[model samples]
Target: MLVVAGAMAETSLVAFRGWPSEALEFYEGLTADNSKTYWTAHLTVYETQVREPMTELLAALEPEFGPGKIFRPYRDVRFSKDKSPYKTHLGAWLEAGGYIQLSADGLAAGSGMYQMASDQLDRYRRAVADDRAGRELTTVIEAIEQARIHVQGHGSLKTVPRGYPKDHPRLDLLRHKGLVTWQEWAPAAWLGTAAARNRIVDFLRTSRPLRRWLDENVGPSTVQR
Candidate 1:
């Protein structure tokens, strides 16, 4: 049962029924035919078969991880050259700092900063340079990787930033522009079962130490979003 305590009366908790097989099929079809006519014809399937289950999954995650906002299906084509009509995947972000996505390829979850503003990057570099904090982060990253999940940065400088020692002990840390934890689940039988949610919950839980390290050492950007 996908019951979140205090969410509502006991009777109101929605049991998460995993995404149906048709959810992937819908995306597969959309990928091939992204025309508005195709979307209009299949709109009902997208809502009932794909969106509903995802909404339930997010609701279930809300009790522990906080509320999540689903991404709008409409694509922003004004600035893009490709000008695709819709996104190939569905995505959402939780207020508590987590992301989820579903598509024909698979489901994915991620957390941590994808990219930091200039000010935040400066602070992050300072923390990474701190001997004790840097070592602690190394341990956290190692543990997460040992669990078979990936820990990586958004973009890394070819070399250490200026003013940082060329031979610094945490050389790799100083080169990072941003840091994040990510995991993906390719289409599988388990994905259609509650195990999908379990795997995500496990990944997020395992990555908690890394998130905590960031919170303590490199918090939210002081710069406006």
Candidate 2:
């Protein structure tokens, strides 16, 4: 179970890094660990249900994303001031992948899993507004938004009052920091389950279609493809 969970987490990281094969190996090593703290600490109800299934899913996805080993522990703080010897958290990036940070105050504070980047965010907003599923860009955007909302709402907000002030620090941070915003299109119920992850993967697999649609509508001159 631990191995499966680790693999699921590593697969997400590896995909972000553009190295699918290495991501598999990364998960393998994590499973070998006797101490399961890493996996245990991160797994939520959704993660717990889908971890094993996602191992096979990631294996199938390996060919598309490429193969490479997990990144070694190293700090590259050339752009930051906090020169800690090691990264405080694990992270990944693929092109303009949005940033996600786990809050120190735990998930219930509603500050975890923020996605940022103004241009990309704008594109996402437009896609949701337009409901373009066949397009590669729209599919990815939808998957991300669905996954993010599920994780954020289910993993956090468990104790938050329904009527918590909109201007509260957490809500304000989500808005000002562009972490998350309310959407009229999204369903009211939470979609935090293994099934939700599978649905997300299915949506992401439409990358080719999305690319074609983006080419036709948005034009190649816009952001990097």
Candidate 3:
């Protein structure tokens, strides 16, 4: 189960890196490993129990976002020192909104669903504010905030766990990147339910249209060059 889930998670990472075929192959190999029969069995459980339905929801969302493009795996490290060889998962670009990460482990554990961190959301908002894109970031942010609120209000009972040191690297990086601000809502729990997942998919569909709109209204910014 973990192997399959991990493969699925890797698929998303690979997709994010723009290698769908490789991601698919990786998943297939992981499932075909006969030595780990129990893992395969567990994989079946998750696929039947979780993956299929999520795939359906994503399919229903296809028209709104158009076709998703896989990003290339090669890292353009001309300017960076830490150059890894390749990205390990597959990601789908949402036309109107943010992106989705798909991984086997993430899927199996239910955490690999949809993730758009506050900082990433904030970057999008800032881009819009800076006229880097056509659609307003505020609009998207408001919609996501509303969705989050809706999820929290009507969905699960999970709360943010405490006790992490204040100097945690992940938290620090998030703050440094301006992805999230330090506030009461800094570590809000994202509801993990089928309904919440559907809402996220819907949001991504709307968000994807930004690509076309941006190309027409704002053009690519200097940073893109």
For lDDT, the strongest prediction is 1
Model 1 TM-score, all chains together: 0.92
* Model 2 stretches with alpha carbons more than 4 Å out: 1-60, 64-72, 92-203, 206-225
Who is ahead in lDDT, 2 or 3? 3
Order the candidates by lDDT, highest first.
Answer: 1, 3, 2
lDDT by residue (tens digit), candidate 3, 1-225: 999999988756422111122234444444454234433444554344334444544454566644444345345667888454333333444443345544432321111113233443344333434443413533543554554421111121133213433443333222221221010111112323334355455444433433334344334234421
**How well is each residue in 1-225 modelled by candidate 2, as lDDT tens digits?**
999999998866533211223233333444454233544543452133223333333444455533212223336768978554343323322121122111111111111224324454444334323434324433444664554432222222334234445444344222322322122112212232233333333433423333334334433223464
State the TM-score for model 3.
0.33
TM-score of 2: 0.27
User: Per-residue CA lDDT of candidate 1, range 117-208, in tens?
Assistant: 98888888998888888899899999999999999887999999998999999898889998989998889898887788898889888888
Which whole-number lDDT from 0 to 100 does residue 90 have in model 1? 89
Candidate 1 C-alpha error for residue 96, in Å: 1.4
Q: After superposition, how far is residue 121 of candidate 1 from its true place, in Å?
A: 0.7
